[model samples]
Target: MLGRLAVDVAIYRDRVQVTERKSGIFIDQRADHPFSSDTQLVADATRFEHALSHALRQILKTGAYMLYEPRAVVGPTDPALTPPERALVRRVLQDTGFRRIEFEDE
Candidate 1:
């Protein structure tokens, strides 16, 4: 349906970012590679690839590059998340294209 097709996509050199703004923050996620014509349901297709790639690698080991559910950029990480647990956050955010948010360890 047209409503389901209204998602946005951002292509990076090494990955594609999909975002949906909620509240005031942007829920940004990366797709591990550049996007092509065959990709579906993209809005605001722009040259933000570098911005994403850089944020993924240069910012904190856990950066805003991976937020599956875009809520207001609130306080720190949940007290229950560990180091590897934190990485799981990264993976889930990356896998948003498939509507997934669970880690193998979970």
Candidate 2:
């Protein structure tokens, strides 16, 4: 079976926005603990990448055996992503043969 999976991700200074297409579910996740005072950019980027990966994995688990046409939605003014973070996202999309990323206004 073939399925369509669309993920909308928006990165913000304090949080990450994720939307699952099939279920129309929206999740706003903090990149780090609210009380943490860490200022390391790398840490922040890692957290974002981990959060994003986890969300994507959860969604993919739903249709493990099906072929998926993945799509990503992001905003141009989205939060600053480190090189590794950007590469990770691109790699994930490429691994899934994702279609063109859709840009949207915040």
Candidate 3:
């Protein structure tokens, strides 16, 4: 892929999975623990974001700073996600600095 194509983010209620599409560097992490939280996802948006950002940084070869310019495919596939929940997902991805975002279900 040309300079790292993109990353795939799949967020579950209690877990988040990220894959760097080019290198296939993937991370499947619980939403709690190091970030500190209950098992429920989105319960604390900051914590969820922290955990996600952490996962992304771990997979991105360059670093989390590289997040801003990259295209990201975010698919939150639990029960198809409600509109507000989808909006939350988008907002979080945007907050993570992804310049381009696509939803797998949309």
Candidate 4:
């Protein structure tokens, strides 16, 4: 995801001749977090949330306040995310101060 975001940033930086002052963030949450068979399922939620927060921070360097437009976060619905995990993700995005956030399962 970071790699893709890097490529996008490069493309945007090159194509943008003027300061648009508006940008959008679209996150594709298709990657799965690996866990050992012995690991408890309960721990997975926290780990995933932490990793997600770290990744988002890395992608949005200056922080969410820098984003001038709404952000959309999408993920697959096959595996499905537990309610708690989804709530955690929403909280993280909100805490980052995103002007608008939309989460959809595709």
Order of the predicted models by lDDT, top scorer first: 3, 2, 4, 1
Q: Model 1: runs farther than 4 Å from truth? A: 1-75, 97-106
The sequence of per-residue lDDT tens digits that candidate 3 reaches over residues 7-106 is 8988776678898887778899776644322443455567778878878767755543343378889775755666766677778878877778899877
Per-model TM against the reference: 0.23, 0.54, 0.76, 0.41
Off by over 4 Å in 3: 33-43, 61-68
Candidate 2 displacement at residue 46 in angstroms: 3.0
Which lDDT value does model 2 have at 19? 79
lDDT of 3 at 16: 84
Best model number under lDDT: 3
Give RMSD (Å) of candidate 1 vs. truth. 14.8
lDDT of each: 0.33, 0.58, 0.71, 0.37
User: What are the per-residue Cα lDDT tens digits for candidate 2 across 1-106?
Assistant: 5457777877655465677767776776665443112442234434556666666666666664333556888755334545565565566556545665655642
lDDT (tens digit, per residue) of candidate 1 on 1-106: 1112112333333343333332122335543343322323221233233334443333223233343442211123223345553453344334323243333234
Worst 10 residues of 3 by lDDT: 33-42
Per-residue lDDT of 96 in model 2: 48
In candidate 4, what are the lDDT values of residues 1-94, reduced to their tens digit? 1212211211010011111123444333222453212322223444444444544554456334434543534333333545664565456546
- Looking at model 4, which ten-residue stretch has the lowest summed lDDT? 9-18
Cα error, residue 103 of model 1, in Å, equals 17
